[model samples]
Target: MTRHLIPLLVFVVIVGFLWAGLSLNPREVPSPLIGKPAPEFALPQLRDGGNIVRAADLRGQVWLLNVFASWCTPCLEEHPYLVDLTRRNLVPVYGLNYKDQRSAALEWLGRHGDPYAGIVVDAEGRTGIEYGVYGVPETFVIDKLGVIRFKHIGPLTPHILNEEILPLVRKLQT
Candidate 1:
């Protein structure tokens, strides 16, 4: 009876810990960057001209900070939507190109439509680490005061844009 009871207790503890881990890791992360200042970053662009973009430049305007990499397959799927977003002028989109070759990143952008207003080359993922990025294709919506208003994890789909992002932008603008 004692042996059986011990195993049951151990199993329960394991299950409890798993549940805690999942619950603690917010699906979107950083609570969608709400009511917090946008993260600061400065990295050189892979594109020519040697210009760099810093997060500080986004102040006094709502903006989107999208993190992606040329190597990530999903990033490819989401690129055109970002281009569409840029075309509509719905909101400003800035990009973080994570840990990839300069030539490859440049080629990818050139082929894809170059939606981002500015691109940061995070070749070591150090900027991603600063923003708490665990994986590719995470997006953060920043408010005019520099606070992060929302963080979107995973690919950017039209449903997410219509249901979650666009409304938030409207709210922030007002």
Candidate 2:
């Protein structure tokens, strides 16, 4: 009887773990880089390969580092919001073009709208890995001192921008 109960107890433990994992929000995945200095990188600008954009150059300003790829479908969904954000000029938005061809990225931005103040190409995705990017469409909120404050793992919707990102940006700016 005790031996039979062992399997049932293990099943219950497994089910409990599964339930906890399922209830957790994927978007809220905690990043280790929060409150830490953002990884330093100097990548070639997407449009003009001759120009280099360095992470250190963006210091002393609150900015958004949006990691995206031309082939990412969710990035398309978030493109309009990013464009609107750029138009508002509330904060500078920089694009980290992750593991994508320069032509494709440029064409996609042309078709959608170029929202970034500057775009840096990371064709091998090495920079993305340094930034702890799990996939494209990840966004990081870097504070004035070049420290990462927040990380959004998915597409940016109006609600998230209004409720979370904007508020954080405002606070960080001050």
Candidate 3:
């Protein structure tokens, strides 16, 4: 009985430490942006001649903002969905081309087919940090009121569409 209790105590201590490590970081805090205003951003266009895109530009419409990098392999995997989304006319899809080469980003879009209605060039990552982007392939769903309604940290999938996304969009409509 004594030996069993010692192992249980050790397990409890380890679990407590693990919880503290994850719970203390603000970065680990899920976005309070949901049901709140999205942080404003003004990023340059990658394709056009240095035009800027702002959070204000997406008001009065539902939009999907995808944070990506030309170098991120997962971003490549998600490109086809972007194309399909644009094709479906489900929502306006925008891309944040994170800290990367201009030529390489363009080449990626060229090779994969540009699906984003607007591509924001965030070469310095300041805008990405403001949006609380921990990594590439994070997506935010902005409602018509220009509020961030949802955030997905990884690749958006068909299952997510069926489960979370479609439901959120339907809710925003009401």
**lDDT by residue for model 1 (1-47), tens:** 99899999999999999989887755644553467777687778666
lDDT of 2: 0.94
| Candidate whose lDDT is highest | 2
Span of ten consecutive residues with least summed lDDT in model 3: 23-32
- Could you tell me which 10 consecutive residues in candidate 2 have the lowest summed lDDT? 23-32
Model 3, residue 130: distance off in Å is 0.7
All candidates' lDDT scores?
A: 0.84, 0.94, 0.83
lDDT (Cα, 0-100) at 29 in candidate 2: 63
Screening candidate 3 with a backbone cut-off below 3 angstroms (N, C-alpha, C), the clashing residue pairs are none
Quick one: RMSD of model 3?
A: 3.9
Strongest candidate by TM-score: 2
Clashes of each: 3, 0, 0
Q: Where is model 3 more than 4 Å wrong at Cα? A: 1-29
79-150 per-residue lDDT for model 2 (tens digits): 999999999999999999999988998899999999999999999989988988986799999999999999
TM-score each candidate: 0.80, 0.87, 0.80
- Winner on TM-score between 1 and 3 is 3
Off by over 4 Å in 1: 1-33
Candidate 3 residue lDDT tens string, 78-173: 778778878877677888888988999998888999888888888999988888898688998889988888998767787786698867876776
